[model samples]
Target: MEFDSEEEAYDFYNAYGGRIGFSIQKEYGNKVNGRIISRALVCSKEGVKGTDKQDRRIFSVQAIDVELASDLRVLACNAYELMGRKSSGKESIGYLKVDLKNYLRTRRQKELLYGNAA
Candidate 1:
């Protein structure tokens, strides 16, 4: 689903993750030019290990601008789709592929539009 703010996005996932068999394991703050511009919600199976690592699956939400934020929404939705598919199949690691896709898409788009927005 589309979110109007980063907090809303995070809240939605955090609140529903447990019911869906995963939980928010970590939150990542993203900076751009020394300013906080985005946040990522990391999720894993209820009993998964090493959740506090950089290699976990995540759903990112950005507060860059209207247009860019819309892109971020799309990325988040795509991540949600992957999470649903993988969780349903009981393939925890498979979800990371979707996270990687979103991450790469976010990076490429930010580079092309915001240049150094990382």
Candidate 2:
């Protein structure tokens, strides 16, 4: 398929995704100088997932999923603490807070995208 502009391609994909009961997102792009030469659009759920840093881990520790915060304000407050007693009452931080934020943001984006889908 060919499009005169990137916006045209996006609009085409977005409309198609709406009809197919899914969401579209800009996946990747290649540019020459300052102009975009190519663009990739894909389903909202498709992407490189967050990965655990294996090299730094001394031993395998089973992670317990916990609801850290219900709202944005609480998440902001709790983001600073490094490995406090939260999960299993153990003083250990599994991952960096920035990684957690990114994970949440990605998850929230997918939810919003699919929730609005037709």
Candidate 3:
């Protein structure tokens, strides 16, 4: 079940309805190969909030039902590691950031209107 790349992880998340959003960062030069990658650690916003701190909320690429999950995890981890490099290029960082921000804003607005954090 260990994923060999991050794409598998991303696809899995997407299939499971856990993906909020994703984008690939743009690169002008060819020094770094352009790769389709996810920029954020995203999950289903409807899941149990408190469970994120427990084992149930942990993101595991190796625990999937398929064999390529490990590779996906590795790819995601590598993307995160190289995210700050000048030579490296991103493909989805912008979209991911925007989605996260909008999601947060919506959540806050709902909380204010409902009077309960939910």
Per-prediction TM-score, please?
A: 0.31, 0.40, 0.24
Per-candidate clash tally: 0, 0, 17
Instruction: Report how far residue 49 has shifted in candidate 1, in Å.
Output: 12
Q: How accurate is candidate 1 locally (lDDT)?
A: 0.52
Off by over 4 Å in 1: 33-35, 44-118
Q: Per-residue lDDT for 16-112 in model 1, tens only?
A: 9878877785444544444434455677543444555455654423223223534566555555444444334323332344455566677678788
On the 0 to 100 scale, the lDDT of residue 102 in model 2 is 58
Put down candidate 3 lDDT per residue, 2-79, tens digits, no spaces.
355666655665665534454332122213446533333344444333422222221232122111422354443343
Number of clashing pairs, model 2? 0
Candidate 1 accuracy as TM-score = 0.31
As a TM-score, model 3 comes out at 0.24
Candidate ordering by lDDT (highest first): 2, 1, 3
Q: Pick the candidate with the highest TM-score.
A: 2
What is the Cα-based lDDT of residue 78 in candidate 2?
64
